[model samples]
Target: MSFKINFDSENVSTGEFQLVAEGKYEASIINAEAKEWQGQFSIGFDVEIRSDVEQKHQGAKVLYNTLYLSSTNPEYAENTEKKRNSFLVACGYSGKQSLDLDEVVKNIIGKSVLVYIKHVEDKNDKERKYPRVSFVAESKVNPPQPSGPPITVGSDDLPF
Candidate 1:
């Protein structure tokens, strides 16, 4: 059985920015890959998103529409050995909207992004099979920030 995986972006974050003109903004696919399975099994992935609006830009507003995904490519490999055991997918986005950073911050900030997965099968190829899949989003704390030089009494010794 053959399978394909894709995401809107490899990385996504919430921030503030000024818009000069009104135009349609779209999220692009950062990366994609496929894996084939020979034995009976299942595969899954976890997706998450983080925002710096609250800490960086307070009271900033923003707007966003529904996220979308599409299957643009479907090419079967000729070599059977090229098949994969399973697939692991992840994505992210970075941009701005009309609203301030604070407005959209609460919606996406410190929140776990969930992705829904569906299986597609070739009607003509009944012999081939695909594994069932599901998605789960878990909220996580922001990553630790890098500390700069530290100021202390006495001589100016570099601190890490």
Candidate 2:
């Protein structure tokens, strides 16, 4: 019997910022440690990113904190050997911003980003299967600024 699966069209969008990046992120031979079969098998990849933004206002200052890697593909599962076959695929911007706070704020307003990724698997030199991929947004923020270096107050300065 033949079976078919359908993905929710409404939930998927091939639009801008849908995937921060797309293309082969990694490839490696399966069971590389196993002797005799070394370099005999491998897996290919394509990755995407989904990013969303929210506006927060602190007085006159507006901060645009973006959410990165909002989602992924090839759905990760627990207790599955297939998990090891996957690589760290992500989409986001890099490099320091030369623009000041005002320019950065203006550049980030009202932006929606999404990334789409795909995995290609092969067995015996023939394509075997393709799986649907998805990822949840995991955001990491920088720490707050610290005031000056540590100060050592002298005992003489202490008030009794």
Candidate 3:
């Protein structure tokens, strides 16, 4: 008649953890927001990993590094621009420069992306680690391929 939440469970069904090795994971931007930080506009993304990353990390999530692309100060313009271009390339939009920030955010919603990331330990605390997106490309999950060519297998071919 009642239920209890098991926060003490050793397994994390959907949470964040350190990825020991460099691995590719399918993720989707669940949230993206532009904020004015220090004097510039920077966009932050909340990327959720939806792949079976070694079974234990199936629903692991991570925060995408944010960079300022627009600043009130003039000194940060050139560097910001370069970072913007790199962002586009990493997001699979290389060679296109006419896209608006809002458009980029909106267009990426619900879109699955394959990201190559690495885990880095926090400087202050060596034991703590976080996942950082190193590169991103189009998701390769869909457009499924057949396991084998069409074959007719009788029950005799199966091993019980």
- Residues 69-148, candidate 3: write the lDDT tens digits: 67665897786777666656656686645777787777655556676777788999999887777656677665224477
* Best prediction by lDDT: 3
Summarize candidate 2's per-residue lDDT along 28-95 as a digit string, tens digits.
11111111123332222222221112221111111111222112323523412233212221112244
lDDT of model 1 at position 94: 35
Descending-lDDT candidate ranking:
3, 1, 2
Give the higher-TM-score candidate: 1 or 2. 1
Against the true structure, candidate 2 has what lDDT? 0.28
The runs of at least 3 residues in candidate 1 whose Cα sits more than 4 Å from the true structure, single-residue gaps closed, are 1-90, 96-113, 131-160
Cα error, candidate 2, residue 63 (Å): 21
lDDT agreement with native, every candidate? 0.28, 0.28, 0.67
**TM-score against truth, every candidate:** 0.18, 0.16, 0.56
Residue-level lDDT for 56 in candidate 3: 36
Which TM-score value belongs to model 1?
0.18
Return the top candidate by TM-score.
3
All predictions: root-mean-square deviation over Cα? 21.8, 21.0, 10.1
lDDT measured at residue 10 in model 3 versus the true structure, 0 to 100? 68
